[model samples]
Target: MTDWDQTDDVGLMLKKVRGIASDRQLMFFACGCCRLVESKLPAVRYLADRFEKDAERPMSRDEKWSILSAIGSALLGDIHPILRQFLMGQDNDSWTMAAQVASIGRMFEFNGAPESLEAAGPSIPRNSASQAQVLREVVRNPDRNIEFDPRWRTDAVRGIAAAIVESRAWDRLPILADALQDAGCEDDELLQHCRLADHLHRPGCWALEYVRETPERSSPNPGDPV
Candidate 1:
């Protein structure tokens, strides 16, 4: 039986976690605990090295939850965002970096800043609409990439549209509708734009007209109004 309470023996257990080939459950538990420990350690250089090494391994469900919980806990206080970024990683594999960005969006929502809400809007992927709503406070930050990359721009646009529709922010509907009309908008993003226009009772001018007039067909969402 692995002793989860043995904080002092974490170094030994981390070695076991690295060596074990078959015991996935134990490996996951050990990795999760190690992540917790890594979050607390002050040595940024060492922690960065460890994060690079461990991030290559697939995180088990338990391990992912553990890390997420740790992030949530850290966000409750005055912990610096830069510190959290260091603990998480500077790359795509760092879920914590995404979480911190999302958390900042939540802060914007609570503070009632619409500009902040718009600024943080594109950080979420299209498949994660529900989560995006929680982080709807987008502000215009000149330093970050608010515009979507062509590769994933469609997904980002659709995701933001879904979040706006869900939030019933009627005032923001025109801005979102305009984004939908961009020549660069993807099919999925166009569909989401149609939905947003329909939801806001402004279907004819921007999205609905475009969908109807354009030869390109969109995937139908059952019972969705035009």
Candidate 2:
């Protein structure tokens, strides 16, 4: 078994994470240790373990926030109930929650798992309509700061595109197309749209066309106005 205390860097810590006991306390401790290490790999691995263990052992609000704090701005795909739990808590840290929400929203986009969103909130029915509403709120919320992490912008765009297409918001298709062309989205993100478009049976989709026509832009220009 891997030794948690001896694990110094992320690579070694990840190996230790698998060896941590399955109980909530151990999981929480591992998560805390992972955060102390301050490495993205450990944080991600810790989150993955917590998410899986959460299935059998429900985490308290404090534990949830602890995990969220460690996950800070990391790309945790899909709408996890843990995120909703964090949001509903009394932390009053809106920025952190927004970042978490944005990450979860991106996950939903990549996986197209509306069920996960439904799982987050029992009140919100698990269906395409409800999922669409949540996605719209996150994407359109001016206060949410969806673009806080530039590395995640492509994920956010892909999520928005998925929601638009999945919701059959045909009226928004042109708008999404325009955004894709102007936003200078990454190739992987554009490819996600192409796959989604094909699955939706919408041939020659605007997103795919945009991907085909536009060359990848170089690193974002700081001087360029948004």
Clashes of each: 11, 2
Tens digits of lDDT, candidate 1, 1-226: 1242222332232233222212222222323322333334323224333433443356554564444445433442234454344434443222333344333423332432223334434532222232221111111111222243344335444555555444545456555545654535455544443444333332112232232221212223233233
User: Tens digit of lDDT per residue, candidate 2, span 71-93?
Assistant: 54333322344544555554533
lDDT of each: 0.34, 0.37
Model 1 segments beyond 4 Å from truth? Answer: 1-53, 79-226
- Candidate 1 residue 214 C-alpha distance from true site, Å: 37
lDDT of 1: 0.34
